[model samples]
Target: MTFKELKHFLGEINVKVDDLYAEKLFNECDTSHSKTLEGSEIEEFYKRLTYRNEIEVIYSKYASSKGKMSVEDLGNFLRMEQREDVGLNEAVALIQKYELDEAAKEKKLMSRDGFLMYLQSSDGLVLNPTHTLVYQDMSQPLNHYFISSSHNTYLMEDQLKGPSSTEAYVRALTKGCRCVELDCWDGPNGDPVIYHGYTLTSKILFKDVIRTVKEYAFKNSEYPVVLSLETHCSMDQQKVMAHHMKTILGSMLLTAPLGGKMPTHFPSPEQLKGKILVKGKKLQSREHSMTSPESLQGEEEESVSEEDEAADLPEEKGMPKKSKLKLARELSDLVVFCKSVHFPGFETARETQAFYEMSSFGESKAFKLAQESANRFVIHNTRQLSRTYPRGTRTDSSNYNPVDLWNAGCQIVALNFQTSDKSMDLNQGKFQQNGFSGYILKPRFMRDGQTQFNPTSIMQGEWLTPKKLHVMIISGQQLPKVNKNKNNSIVDPLVRIEISGVPRDVCSAETEHIEDNGFNPSWNKNFQFDICVPELALVRFVVEDHDTASRNDFVAQYTLPFMSLQNGYRHVPLLTKEGNPIASSSIFVHIMVVDQ
Candidate 1:
């Protein structure tokens, strides 16, 4: 993007920019001396503008011209910015705890390198650079954990009339999505196409989608990719899909059983590293009822859309009549691990169980299970994988709350990634921890075969003691600049801290807002919460500009798992709407945890 174009884009996002800074940034990123950024240079330009450089900014405040800061200087800086009552001695101890002092070759001093190391560690507000990939144990069965997934991974906007592109797959995969859906139908020229059938969603070639997946399947992590295929094609087209996937994916496709015998337990991600498994209706085996005619008829009514039904008939003069397709043996062989099926209530599902048989439930069915058969659902998921998807009525591509299903141990709670609403926000926050690897091991109770824990029926009196959480929102440093326009520029910024957990009513906490100054706006206000259960708690910090006439406009926000929180003085780095870290933007706070 050119400097002028970049300025206009920033303006549309309500960001205030000065010409000098814009020109300088453009020049720095313009490697070819072409005045405009090209290729990866454009992404580099945006990163430089949006990504927060928190460590260098903090170090400059305390470091001298000699590029080193004394221990006393570091202690005083921490006292003023983080813990107001931190004694010099205590600050020194905290510094040592974070290993900032050790980075210095000389004793009693912190060098520039030491400050950078501290910022990259768990002690600083920024995310650890290495935390975005696989950092958790992958030895557990795939059925025993929650996997990050996206629904209709091709749609970029409204389901009925939106563009479908390979970029959608690229975005979700880069964000650590493990399971993605592919709705394939026969397209012109004998190639399969992916789109939301029955809607006006634009289509992309199946081969193009597969190519994109091949390039990015293991970019974020080596965990296997689950391709949830919804097929609407003839047997010939099914052969084409199998051939394209085999040739394109090569050895990456899991086409056979792991060993000679059926797997006693699902394979761990480590065992299927860099492989892609297809999930679709397989040809019927006499033992498995999922492929029965009655089951397929019932699922067709639930999964097929009006547009898809219309396509089946010869509506136009040149249009060919769509015929019912069967799963070819070649295609069925690819679904050896996970065979997608319809959920047949609780009783029938329990009687004939197959480890490879995976069933999906829409929002209504899953809600009924949660409300009426919570324990049954939880126990079933412990031994079998269950996928929960948004109801068909959600044409806008909106999402429902995925927590209830997650609480019941559903492995794949798919959401519409194209929408950045609160539902998607919660999904991002849930997977932000545990290395952001698109998979999280289920909690002990959910995995342990003996425990019959119900998320909605937790007894408050069962536990003897409840924990207390204390937090002080000291100040915000280098916050993002927001304004209406040049004439009505500047904003009155404030911070709101939200506490979320299982029961929605107990989630809200009263917090006083800080006013006026965007840079270094300090509230120093303390807030407390009595947590009956800490295992399901989540904390979200939102920075918004307080306005009298309308709702508070958002400036920046950050959310994460409360269990991953760092105690003592800590910085909370913020993320923009694009999910990139903001440069030099963070909220400083002091945290204290007490168990009653």
Candidate 2:
């Protein structure tokens, strides 16, 4: 083929074939030096183009020099490199699983192509199969687990003008979110409705939201779902809301604590599977003793959590000190295991906090507590659940960094799921483990009150086993075009990796961009990170398109817990900005975790 034709052909296919690649192919394949020659040259060009030299080196090293990986060779590689303890039977089974050649399978050998296929398969993905399964101890109390939670679950867009629909609840549920927020207000015709109250956002009926929740609650995960209600309805309307939940949810709704009495510890996710728990203001006899109608109004103001109090308060504009609406007896009765209560100081909470009662904090307050009393916050969480949510000032419905709150052992670090960003990525990554059950057993230090674990003290004492993380970005395959509208605009793709955790462990680094190459870019770049507390650290791999004149545009990313990552040669799936995996798009990588 002529050079002009070759360049056009390269343009059609999504490969990073620049001038260097074109000239080398033309000079070597054009054996006759004819400008317009064709023959085995076409075959020669394609062969050299798709070949991966990095993989070839490993295959050559362990394939008995016979161009095939025998069971023993595969076993040795897994043991030494992948750190997997495999036996003869296991290696044979893997060969059968990955080997496409029938003859090679019968002889218990994996061809080079088969090896590459295996490396690209799910087994080769960075997430370990064990983590994808329900592998953790699930019998611990609910407070001992990190619950996958969402804030403003009904909003499909921005906080002020976004439309609120039941579909939002369905989406969050399907993604294994265990906790969802519902802002209920009085609606027309005595029916209650849900929306961002006092905002321009649209609203949906309360009954419809409950029905949708009932149907999709256990579809993705059988674990319990917590409905965090910020109710503003009058007593009569609140009774109607409770009736709807009772009739629609049936036995799935937990109306009373298990065993019909309060216990020192809450039920485990395993114990409450398929149940929906109501988290709202519950009336205390002391607060409700005043029979007068005027006194009843004060009960709601006192019992509501601090985060809920600021829900409708406009920033700087200030809301009027209206009479606090009373909580209905029926709706309050439905709040079984998760009764929302106002947060007192850390000292007060440690002394008077009940296991069944929980408190929600605005991001600023939660972070302040985490900073001033790291060990105290950890101890408080060991006995009672704490939820940290976005501040009211996030008019755009943005998310706060959850890793910092999570480090303090807050079980429910709620984020706006509709706003996909670094926060949601971290949330998804943390909950993606333990079979995506929406619950993860907390580390022993975080769950044990007597352990004296402090989030900020990891750098001082030898409490945590720090490790050296070595990541080698081998190459990228079929990275999507950032500007999809520009058919001829090829991306100069680069990989940016970040480690987020406590103050000291947070850092990031990037690779040099591959010019005009969104497809088949070989970086072979390596980065090292010293993770002091791997338990709390999150590793994020972000791919971006380089633009010298402007800031780099985001391409794709994947984030996961540092502890959940599998070592050795693995392929990382590239996810879009919305967290959906791009088809046939992945970056090949080599990872090693060494003890410090």
Every candidate's lDDT: 0.73, 0.85
Best by TM-score: 2
List TM-scores for all candidates, in order: 0.77, 0.91
User: How good is model 2 by TM-score?
Assistant: 0.91
Compute the lDDT for candidate 2.
0.85
lDDT of 2 by residue, 1-596 (tens): 78888887666556546688688878888887887548787888777777878889988888993778999999988887787877888888888899999999988899998898888888889988889989999899999999999999999998889999899999899888999998988999999999887678999999999999999999989999999998878878999999999999999999866776566688888889899999988877522332333554544423333347355466444544455677777887788778788888778887887777788888888999999888889889998889888887798989999988888999999999998898888888888888989998888878887767777766454457789999999899888877666666788899999999877789999899998877689999999999888888889999998989999998999988898899999999989888888998999999999999
Q: How far off is residue 335 in model 2, in Å?
A: 0.7
lDDT of 1 by residue, 287-370 (tens): 133234354433211222112213322354665565455666567767877876666666787787677888887787888897
Pairs clashing within candidate 1: 51-583, 52-582, 52-583, 52-584, 53-583, 53-584, 198-307
